[model samples]
Target: MTDTLLKTPLYQAHVDAGAKMVPFAGYDMPVQYGLGVKKEHLHTRDNAGLFDVSHMGQLRLKGANAAAALEALVPVDIIDLPAGQQRYAFFTNEQGGIMDDLMVANLGDHLFVVVNAACKEQDITHLQANLPEDVTLEVITDRALLALQGPKASSVLSRLAPQVADMVFMQVDNVSLMGVDCIVSRSGYTGEDGYEISVPQDKALELANALTAEDEVEWIGLGARDSLRLECGLCLYGHDLDTETTPVESSLLWGISKVRRQDGARPGGFPGADIIFEQIATKAISKKRVGLIGQTKAPVREGAKLFDADNNEIGVVTSGTAGPNAGKPVSMGYVKPEFAALESEVFAEVRGKMLAMTVSKMPFVPQRYYRG
Candidate 1:
């Protein structure tokens, strides 16, 4: 069965380190290492954890009108984005439903986009169909992506690439790490100070080994990655977000840049702009995404039904886990708009019984991104 699965550049390294391999997004990826998920989760919060994320799709959008052409597809201020900076964005359908969430970095002459692994092919096709003749999309297939995350990420990376120390959150730069040319970004999905390094496929294993060789760094698998992001309140595309979920309904209105809003300079040109703007203005969303904290020891998992005080079904749990760092069961799911308030009591049906949960403010742990 594993013979048919796609392998990343670091697949051998993961196996060498005793990683439990699993199928994710058509790739044979690591779900946990010998250190275990709980220890891996705490290690990332306390030190550094290296993640192999090469399955994600990388694309370079080049052309003089690339920024403008891309802006017409998503509700983000892509035109005004300063060079060497990154922004979070998503593709919206005609109904204002989010197709996928992605990160866009202005690379001066072009835009560097990192999209969800599962949606890459679809995203590439979408861009190809919608973008004008002036813009050319190049799917980067020969590069591997690695994420070094934690409070000590900077120190660990700076040892190999001193220039990375100068970069702040959301900043991107081309630097030579261990003599290898790479694109390094001071950004990551985990709510921690980190660097996402894009290196040549041939040099990926060498770079991964160098980073893991650091005393403060260790191999972290997908299990810990999920828990870390969950504690940080980050959304996982297929689960917490989907094509039918609009940004407003997902409580992701902040991702819609101010300049692209109804009152902003270049207003309402993207797909579903009219519907998204109406929802923003009228505050008429039926359900909204919110953080959930299990009041009991039992973990409330995805697909679990949620209910209100009167036992009325309100929503379903999208993601949940025993947060090693948060020290409890943390989850995020959609609930009726009226029951989305912080401290609001809700019940999650687990194992044929309702488990107590509460609506909580997210980043159940505080975000520690280095903004300076």
Candidate 2:
């Protein structure tokens, strides 16, 4: 009954299915359904799990200057994207800090963008206020998002729509399914070979019902979603990334396009171009966000202190959890570059005791993306 709670289109469905709802990013989203997080996590890894992500924000950019205007906002080379291709980019602030990360899909003549639910409103405002006069931003709230993720996701989806089997990772296409037009993209945050489907608001339920009718597909809630992304080394917005973090320090420099890092000629004229460009030139970052696996039962949560062997606090935990796949307490946080090397030993302060930790290579679980 809180006035601040926003509801996704499948809110009623979740309620009817006995989901335990909680407030997240202003939405009354299901934390876990009748199945617990552990069960849901295993189900998604073995078979197919459907997640209602309609709370995520989708938008379209149109006009002759659409690509150019978008390029100005992020470090990615959006202007160079080919038709029907999708590229991941970041939204930066004036001080070279990342405001949010987004996916930009070049749908032929125009651009389709998907941003996190927590950042949609601000992202839209930023685009509207900063984009060139020739470009126009259109919010696509009339659509719904569904993610079918797992080893069997492709099989289930292909059965529903044959053309989906031909789609490669990060590639998107418009196709008709069950008499409804839908946009399907072979991409997901769970490190599984999956697809994200965008459908008309009215037809969303019908499409979801059809997909769930398959024996391989089960409904998944947000509880397992977090653990899945964590095991995959994907950063969560407010926890691991924020307006205070930059793409470079966050190990997201790959998202920065080479053309954007050219000599005096910056690719785009967005905020903090100078600082971002300078970092590209120096290649010397002050701190780095890296992954760590510890040998202790005490779970390190966000804001936990990261200390060197001598107990000197070096950084803080951005995100931490008991990785279901890793079967251990794995975490990510920012640390001084010197202590961020692979195999470097460190400690996480749990209460008053220091738990042993080491800087390890991330993606504790291997990614199963089908690029070919």
Candidate 3:
């Protein structure tokens, strides 16, 4: 039952804004407002949309050995990450399977990390259990996060925090917004120019009110967030990624650092690095993730079986949606390596009938991140 679900710091604010609340990730979240998912999705693509992402786990790891301790868990080059910059990374199991994908930013004295909401508890336990006694984990439960995204996001944010105007994509630092200290990161999951603001819970409403008061900013909900991320080919933790899948199979090998993967560098020390590096060199994986476009109007749903021309079961759909911007049904799933090639024709069995589709490239819509 959703009765026992938790509420974020913005729970009352969402209700006051007339949000359609639903249970998600053990929290009551807004699925949409009166604008509907399509308009909300487009609004974020064309203008700035404020999102309540306080449910995501925020943490800080500190100590002289923190960076080295973290590098032992993730495959990214954490030791080389410059202060005020963030790197994308994921936790791996001993078998090279993904435990969770996350963002890590170097804040000089400590490392700031953000993990998936559903995986937060276990992630914290995993990190604490794995790190040495010298390293300490501090959970920031008093902080709430807001994501402002789209083409006009920069202009809207600059009005309140002008120093952030100079911040480029993937950069992060503490900035004052309306006199409230906030950790503003120039990054988002929507594949657009945006900022993720972390503010004290007591001061969160003030920050949210100020940003949404702008003509360019409006409240967006989780339904649009999912579709937006899907359109960008960003994977959802439980669906596109799982404990049984490796980074190479999920098309996330790009997130692995060159220094960690190649020889002569601090290489292959993280869990499952042997299998992952072997897959990187040999390409022996049987299946891989690829994008798909529906030739028909039917929107393909998840778990629908994918088949070859001979009707042999090849793979399963992981994520799908009617892309509002692309004006076509876009989806992502795994298929055999031979069928993973772009433009390769395949059939998706939807409602017991085979529908034709092609292996298409991702980010079905173009990304507009403001990287300097």
RMSD list, candidates in order = 0.7, 1.6, 0.9
Kindly list the per-residue Cα lDDT of model 2 for residues 1-372, writing each as its tens digit.
Answer: 646798878888888878899888889988898889988988998898999998899999999989988998898888878887798898999989999999999988789999999999999999988988889899997899999999999999998788888888999988788888888889998888999999998998888888888999889989899888888899999889999877878998778887887542456477888787777678677889999888886667788999998889898888887877788888999999899999998898887889988898989889888898
User: Of models 2 and 3, which has the larger TM-score?
Assistant: 3
Off by over 4 Å in 3: none
Task: Highest TM-score: give the candidate number.
Answer: 1
Per residue, candidate 3 scores C-alpha lDDT tens digits across 158-189 of: 99878888999999999998888899999999
Candidate 1 TM-score over all chains jointly: 0.99
Give, for candidate 2, the lowest lDDT window spanning 10 residues: 261-270
lDDT, candidate 1, equals 0.94
Model 2: colliding residue pairs: none
- Off-target runs (Cα >4 Å) in candidate 1 are none
How far does residue 359 in candidate 3 sit from its true spot (Å)?
0.5
Q: Sort every candidate by lDDT, greatest first.
A: 1, 3, 2
- What are the lDDT figures for the candidates, one per model? 0.94, 0.87, 0.93
